[model samples]
Target: MMLENSKYLFDRAQKFIPGGVNSPARAFKSVGGTPVFFDKAKGSILTDVDGKDYIDYVGSWGPMILGHAYEPVIKAVQETAAHSTSFGAPTEIEVEMAELVKRMVPGVDKIRMVNSGTEACMSAIRVARGYTGRDKIIKFEGNYHGHGDSFLIKAGSGALTLGSPSSPGVTKGTAKDTLVADYNDLHSVKELLNTHKDEVAAIIVEPVAGNMGCIPPAPGFLNGLRDLCDAHDTVLIFDEVMTGFRVAKGGAQERYGVTTDLVTYGKIIGAGLPVGAFGGKKAVMDVVSPVGPVYQAGTLSGNPLAMAAGFALLSELQDKPVHYDQLEEKTTYLFNGLKKVFDKWDVPVHINRVGSMISVFFTDEEVVNYQTANTTDKELFRDFFHEMLQRGIYLPPSPFESWFLANSLTQDMIDKTVAAADKSIEAALESSKVDSK
Candidate 1:
């Protein structure tokens, strides 16, 4: 692929934008290279600024489940935008969106829209605090609930990619109230709850750990949390920002059959637009805003364009319901194919997947949490990433992030990606050997 255009764009981008990208992970600091500048995308392929075509696995970080340039979503956005974008007030579409979400997701009695996942999560925690009248929140390590101040400690994805889990600006007072627990370990949670007693307001977690690369809940883990929360009168908040609707039509809560007091969702609900939401039982959500004292407000909370696009995408899913099966089949096919390729190369890689979310860790150890996830051979992963990029396979830029598979990915693309992986693994091994010397 030609890189002249991409290189030029990145150079210009760095002069104005910190780290040459708006998102920290986009800087490719974890992989050590220039990020590809995409010009357009359709179905499963991304066309970069250099005019090179590549299979997309990132799926715009989990909202492009239907694929890029999806006609229905585009048309909906265009039509809705014609009647003014922001009202700073409620619209019927907002009600329609909430009703559709209620229809698809059985437990949510009411939902409030926000501009991004960060807002959804931050708002949910405040609601929890207000409703429970407690001062602390327990968050699982490596389970990123956006960059909210309380969530920055031991955060995953962008934070981990930059080699810093805790950021500098977060205050010591804020950090004190945010308790960190180990993912998949019920004992650590028990210890925290025991230590905090009635002081903990909520236990927020990513039902399927995506930030540290697609680690699913261990058997009975989520249920255990529910029990613990119930016993302690603590609210359980599901940060389904990445897994919502992608894993299932109703999100992980429906898939796992584990109910939570509140749930936070991200880009998937907006059909890849800038939107998010946090809602669950009316009892808890009533604590937020006009109903109660806990304050939360946004200028573009229910922007018509986002509401229209989300309704279109979600209605399609609710009607067909076959997209989930297709997504599962394709994701499993790619996972198995890539597994065979890695096995053939004698590489010690551990791959984890739940529904369409998956990741490849360079270590042989099962990546159940942050500690095991860190054991991955990042140097080898960097080499493998570049090699795969060279072969027109656009993976997530960092090892710590999950690779979101889209339903638009066809069998042919999967086969091509598997074929590319064989050569990429070989080249990566060679590069690793040279690096050692």
Candidate 2:
């Protein structure tokens, strides 16, 4: 629990690296603390710079599904690196990876590899616009599809209106092309579609929302989107960067039984490496360059190292369906344990989960969308987060991100986590009472 070294690193990182962290969230601005710098991780245990070990639930934000330092993934990366990393052209592993994805995923007939989820999404939207000859797209609120300019948009005063740029760099022109809709609300989407008519080229969603704390699609929501897309002749894109292989072998589309026109993937595909892809119905993907007019290219698009690691990891998941089931069991154990603790404390919390992805919101209201998800008591969560960290349990630093459980977690580790939660809650509640006093 002694984070002296972490504190030192943070100070140095701030002077050299902006905010001492590459990512804004990692700066611990939300949770108000020093972010622990990790030295190494094995299985479910993370060894911080000071050598403090905590059971990991972040799972590198959802790519280390099988766990950190997993032999297969590590071995694949090492072996592939021996043959040199980037070819800048074509390789057999990339083809194997794409073929595997097409086989495992439901609707992907042809796929194109990209460097990151943002690239995949950006490319996909371009393709949708090219194919449909339209310039606008609709995206659900609170869905994080990376830092793509188009994705960084805020709802403009009301639903059924053009969005405004959330970030300073994004132009009004970019924002105007993106429309924001309410998650889990088909009425909002229908309203936008009606207003926009054939102007919208595509609709992108996070299928199982992770950014606004793991909100699942409402009943018939995905199907509703499917029908609407078909009716409008608009392409539907599921940004499965988080849910791709983590929810199920086939992802949210398979889990919900609703397929999309195009799907973008990241996270699990690279086995924690920086890789992403977009693919779906052959007719639509055929619009991309080398085959069609739409141009999307990356020098390191199919980096051999990432492809090798991804293929190795995905092949395991494909061969052993039990990994997903075991992950579900472990996640359920944690969820139920946390629920019991909260119930015993008479603390009303909203826990939304889809398969292994889950989030704990400090609110009694059902977290069906971003607005409801915002009702969470931030102070309470911040207190709980610090207490959990002190007790060797690492949760996502923010209340809005999902806690990804790795199957590497054992029953003992889970029990220990529950016990930690019990004590942590008691201490956190006491702190809250003192702060109020």
Candidate 3:
């Protein structure tokens, strides 16, 4: 209820950091409030600098699946730091992490480590183009693949949060090459492929789109993309930066039963650290760097600390695979509860969920793509955001972002969140009416 300290911190941060946050969305500009500066997070709870506690649903934007400050990840990082940090040379842990990732993620036989999802995605597109001898790539409008120049066209996440899906500074040439498609719509993709034909190199997608509020592919949509890619010789790349490891050990590829030629991973891979990777069949990956002419390298690509943290997290996930099951149960429970709350208030809302990723739009229209998602009432979302924050429930500050659930969220936490939702929904409904007047 008290945000005096958080307000002071934000004021100070604004002096140096742009918008009082390193990330655009963290500024809470969309939600209309001073962003809470978290002092610490343990398990599923976050304690703000103002000493207010909240059940965290953002999960550090999808990397804290096993929960914040997970012991194994911490110990691994500390142990690795004891020996050394970055060697600028080969390490066994890198090989082990790659192997573990390949084993956990189906269809990946080789991999390249990178510092962030943007790097991995940008590198993946390069490799795809090099291997296929093509120039164009297709990506869904609302499915974010990071800040790569090619991916900035109609990108989501922070881009959407700041009301600039098409950022400035991206060259016209880069934008021209990156073809935009609609999520869950096979016809849009088909039209592009039909026109471009052999010129398109890869069709990248988030199989379970999280950037535009956790919208899952409509039935047979993924299969349609795979088939189209196969027929046209376009590489099917799954940008699983958010869904990888969190949705399942094998990720959306396994969950949806559709395999891709190359898969990019981040988020849970580093257990909240700065790490990302891309991999697939050896024949395709062989085109990268030392194997062939397609060059992609990172100085901190496989830094010891990130590799150790990733390895520790992946190892635990492999051993205890049911973490996803628990996550799904919790998410489903929360989803149903929120739906009930919305129904009680008679609020016009739509929620999309899969596994632990979920989102609620303040619109009655079904959120199938970027166009429909934009139809949501942003003003209503701002009110609901503040209402929930007042009651100690921290959600994604933007409506278009997914609510990432951590495995550490207990039944009691879910209950408390549902109770908060009931009040928040009522308040949002009243606020929307006021705004309309």
Candidate 4:
């Protein structure tokens, strides 16, 4: 648990990188510590610079579904790299990747690749606006669709963790067009649609919310959105960046039996590489540049390395669809084990899980949405996080983020995690009591 090396690296990183981390979540600011600098990771274990090993659950923020350095994906990247990297033009692998996506995903007739989830979402919003000829887009509170200017208002994930749901750089004009709604509350969406009427372009949501800690959509919540969008002629967008490929073969849309007008993907789609995509019905996607006039382009959009890696990972997932079931079973085992530990320790906690995405909120209240998710005692979670880290279990630094379990995690790892939780919960509770005294 000694983070001396990590501390040194953090200090060095701070001299160059903002907050000593490229991503705010990596700073461990909310959890109160210097972030661990990993030397390498393989399977479910992350080896830090100091050579300490911990069972990993963050999974590089949801991309390492098959686990870090998965052989097939790595091999694909290596082979593709031997040929070349970015062409800035077109490659056959890109077409193969797109075709594979269309085959696996439910409603993706056509797709456009992007460098990141943020780009995918931002581009999707533009397509929505161009197709509908409307300005406003409705996004649920705590449903982070990346750092796009339009998506910053009431955003979650890093924004929520950093206590700035709306960043300052986002102009008022952009904010005005992005309406925020309460997740799991259909009435809030109805109110926005009623007020905005035909002016709204799209309604975007994380089908199974991962940013606000894996809050599954309430019963009929997604279907409700679908119905409302159908009635209002507004595009329905599912920001499946975290859940795609990991939750199921086709993602939340397949798992829930709900089709969306557009779907944005990241994480598992790239198989730990930096890649993203937005796809939907042919008609809606046809509006994007060269086809109709929504201009969105990326120099490295379909970099050969990314396409090969993504295709390799996805092909495996497609071939062995049972991996999804295995992942869910493992997650359920871990969840139940953790629950038993909390119960045994008399620790008040609420757990929310869907497929392999899960969260442990240090509160008794059910975490159905961002507001309820925020009710969890941050101090308690901070204590729990450190305690678990000390015991060789690495959880997401912030409670607002979901813990993505990888297929690489074995029963032994789950058992160890549960055992760690047992001790960590007691230690955390003891620390809270000591602080109160």
Candidate 5:
């Protein structure tokens, strides 16, 4: 594909925006080459600034589960914007959105809205500390809970893609309190709890771990965490920023049949808008401001526009329970297609998928945790990503990130994506052979 416009724009963007992109992943550093600037997106396709159209699989990092520029969400935003945007006061729409969330999510009784996933996670931890009266917290190595100062230690996704899991500027005091554990390894967490004991406030995790390429908890991992937390009086937190509403109606807590004391939500909840929320049992949530002592606030926390879009999206989801079924079928179809195609070429790739979230790791070893996920042949993945891009497919620009499937993708779109992967697999194979020689 020609990239005259995109290339020109990227050059200009670099002069103004650091590294020519607002987000690190958009720089395409992990996948190689300049990032394609999108002009518009509709349903399952993204059109680049240069007029090149490609099947979109990233889905705006999981918020576009209903697909880009969904009619209901767009219309709701438009209609709500006309009524005035941010009042900085309480709104009925906010209550409606909260009600919908409480009804859909398994354990939430009261929710506090935040501006982004990062804020939601950061504030949730503070609430857990205040509720439990403990200081230390345990987080998994690869499960990113957004860029809260504490979470930046051994984080995944954009942090890992940029070659720095431990970002600088985070204080030593913050890092000391944030203990690291391995994902899918109950023993690791057990060891942390054994050492920290009563000092641990909460154990937070990405229930389906989309940041490190969609690694699900090994069989009994989540259950084990719940048990450990209960025994130790530690709060269990599910960071469902990516999995909430995408994996299941009640999020990972429902999908995995596990209930957490607190859950953080983002992405899909906003219906592609910038919104996030955290909530749990009423007792714990009452600790938040206005109701209790722990304070947190945001000007656009429950903005009318965000509430309207989210309400429309959730209403459609709740009304049409078949949306989940359709997503699973489509995802399975694509998963099986990729598996068959890669196996036929004798490629040793492990694809991890749960619900609509998935990722193809360029490794023969099973990717159950951060260590295994890091063993992927990143150069091979870069080649595969570029090849897919050339074939009119827009994948997550980083090897570590998961590919999110939107409900708007048709069977034809999935088939086209599989076809592109078939070609891309061969390209990756050739590149591997050349590197080995």
Candidate 6:
């Protein structure tokens, strides 16, 4: 597709905005091309500035589950905006949102809203530390828990894509308390708990890791972590910013049947609005703000506009619980179709999927953790990505990121996407053969 206007916009944006994008993932640095500037999106389609329409698979990085400009969400936002935007005070909508969330999600006794997932995660850790009176926390490798200073160490997604999991700005002192463990590996977590003993306050993890591709927790992985936390007197936190309400209504905790002490949410909770929330058992959550010693506050925590949009989106999901099943069916269809295409093209690829979240890694090995996920042939993926883009299918810019499927995608779109994959795989295979020679 010709992106002249997008290129122009990017050039102009770079004069003011660093890397011509606010978010690093939007820069298309890993994909080796100019990022397409989208003018508008509706349903499962994104129309770029140059008037090229592509089937969107990124879903705004997991928020647009119902799809872009979904009627209910848009209507709610419009209706709420006419009243006011931010009041800096509590509203009935906030209370309603909390009640609705608690009704749908399991194990959440109280929830605090925030502007973004990063803030939710950062505050959750602070609350955990305050509640437990311990300073250290263990985080799994390859699980991107937002870009908080503590989470930057061995982070995934943007950090891994930029080849800097440990960012420069984060101080050494901040990194010390953050312990890193391998995902899908129970032994590593047990080892960390044994070494840290009473010093560890919490164990944070992405129950269904979306960063470093879509890796699901191993057979007993989540339960094992829960057990370890129980034995160590540590708070177990599920950073479900990506998996929450996407994989399942209540998220990984609900799907896996393993309860967590704290859970952080983003994306779907705000219905694509800038919002996030962290909630847990009343005892742990009580430590935040007026009730307890932990200091955490957001001026725009539960902005009326955001609450309305989120409530609308959540209500739809609540009313139509079948949407989850429909999403799974579509995702399975796409995954199976892609697998068939790769097989036909004789391209060695590993596809990881969990519900509506999926990833295509150009490798034969199973991608269980960061180490294995890194073994993918990025060059082949870049070729595949461009080929798919050219065929009007928009994939995640980086192999480290998950492709979020929206309910808006029809069977026709999935079939077209499969056809695109067939051609893309052929081209990628040809390119790999040429490179080998």
Worst 10 residues of 1 by lDDT: 25-34
Report the lDDT of model 1 for residue 155.
Answer: 97
- TM match of model 2 to true structure: 0.97
TM-score of each: 0.99, 0.97, 0.98, 0.99, 0.98, 0.99
Score candidate 6 by TM-score against the native: 0.99
Candidate lDDT scores, in order, read 0.92, 0.89, 0.90, 0.93, 0.91, 0.93
Give the range where candidate 5 is weakest over 10 consecutive residues by summed lDDT. 23-32
Give one digit per residue, the lDDT tens place, for model 6 in 383-402: 89999999999999998999
Residue-wise lDDT of candidate 4 within 322-379, one digit each (tens)?
A: 8998998999999999989989988888999999999999888999998999999999
Better of 3 and 6 by lDDT: 6
Clashing residue pairs in candidate 5 (N, C-alpha, C atoms within 3 angstroms): none
Q: Show pairs that collide, candidate 6.
A: none
Q: Residue 206 of model 1: what lDDT?
A: 95
lDDT, model 1: 0.92
Clash count list over all predictions: 0, 2, 0, 0, 0, 0
TM-score (C-alpha) between model 5 and the true structure: 0.98
lDDT measured at residue 405 in model 3 versus the true structure, 0 to 100: 93
Quick one: how many clashes does candidate 3 have?
0
Worst 10 residues of 6 by lDDT: 341-350
Candidate 2 wrong stretches, greater than 4 Å: 155-165
